[model samples]
Target: MTAPEPGTDGQSVRPRMAQHYSVAPEPDAPEGYVAPGMPGAPVAGYDPAPDPAEPSAGRRRRRRRRRTGLAVAVSATAMLVGALAYGAALSRVQSSIGWLAIALAAAVAWPLGRIGGQNRTLPPLGALLSATGLLLGQLLGQTLRLHRLEGTPYGELLGDALRIWRADRHPVDLAFYGIALIGGFLLTRRTASTD
Candidate 1:
């Protein structure tokens, strides 16, 4: 066989290679296949490298998600523990100790605000959830205690709990919620992405 001559452009005078094409399978589509353009169309060059900002953006997002989750978990745990502590103390200390529960609620905001993601809304959101949980816990304990005293039946306990949930809340309880809300706003701050 005769060797092919090189082009004057310093490139080999070679036959064109077979073109390659790829299509994604779609169940609902015709023939269960989907391609960018019609058949026999010129195949455009495709750069597989991802965008410059994609990895960083994704990493930051994942990091933020982790931080947000951590903040929420911590806040919730603090609120529950606080509620239980306050309930236990309430049974023991005769003097007023409501402030302790409020303080606990307020304290949750610090960690949440400090570690919660860039969303300025998260701190206050966490605080609100925590405060609400605290109030619910207190009400729950009160309802259980009252029900026990009244010798409430197991089947009717649900009704009693509902009544307690809808009962008029004390101003002190409202104050605690407000403190937690404000404290959350105060403690929350934007932090640099660690990743």
Candidate 2:
């Protein structure tokens, strides 16, 4: 069989070659329309969709601050309650049950630290709050005791309480204080992530 001639059997060789090689034409775009990723595109009214998986930085920061604030408030309130309870008990009872304060401090501090979130500042904050609570409890107990015994005036109660607590200190009290400090510090430490 010989080579097919042009337009043979009503089919042109040029048309077949053109059909094989021709590229599809691009669609016409509207005026002022810029294709995505093109340089200097106006992008009028174009708001990029935010990523749902990742929150905005400002939102994250605000959330963190709110959490930290809540933690601090709750921890401080707990310490205040513990101190008041301890002081009340100590004032009423002549026996030395100060060791119980260690448990109270750890109990309050550990949960506070965990609630405070994973941060570098939590342990030190817990320890400071614990120490403050213990000191306040002692002073308050002494103040209440003096008030009960001598009807001490409100203005002079603090000074008298300080003097009384200073005079009443014992070596055993120091040991208990140190243990409380250690417990608060250690128990408030960040736990390993189970995740």
Best by TM-score: 2
For residues 1-195, write the lDDT of model 2, one tens digit per residue. Answer: 766676757764654443443776665988777777789675779867879897877887788767767777887888888888888888898877788768667765765666667656777777778877888888888888888998968578999889878988999888777766777777777531211
Candidate 1 stretches with Cα past 4 Å from truth are: 1-57, 91-96, 151-158, 161-168, 189-195
lDDT (CA) per prediction: 0.63, 0.75
Give every collision pair in model 1: 113-188
Worst 10 residues of 1 by lDDT: 186-195
Q: How close is candidate 1 to the true structure, as a TM-score?
A: 0.52
lDDT of 1: 0.63
Kindly list the per-residue Cα lDDT of model 1 for residues 1-195, writing each as its tens digit. Answer: 986888999777898787665965445766635466967544679545687867766787888888888977887787777777665555354344455544665656656766775666675675676566566555556555555668876457756765764684567766766766665555554321233
For model 2, the run of ten residues with the poorest summed lDDT: 186-195
Score residue 191 of candidate 1 by CA lDDT: 29
lDDT of 1 at 193: 28
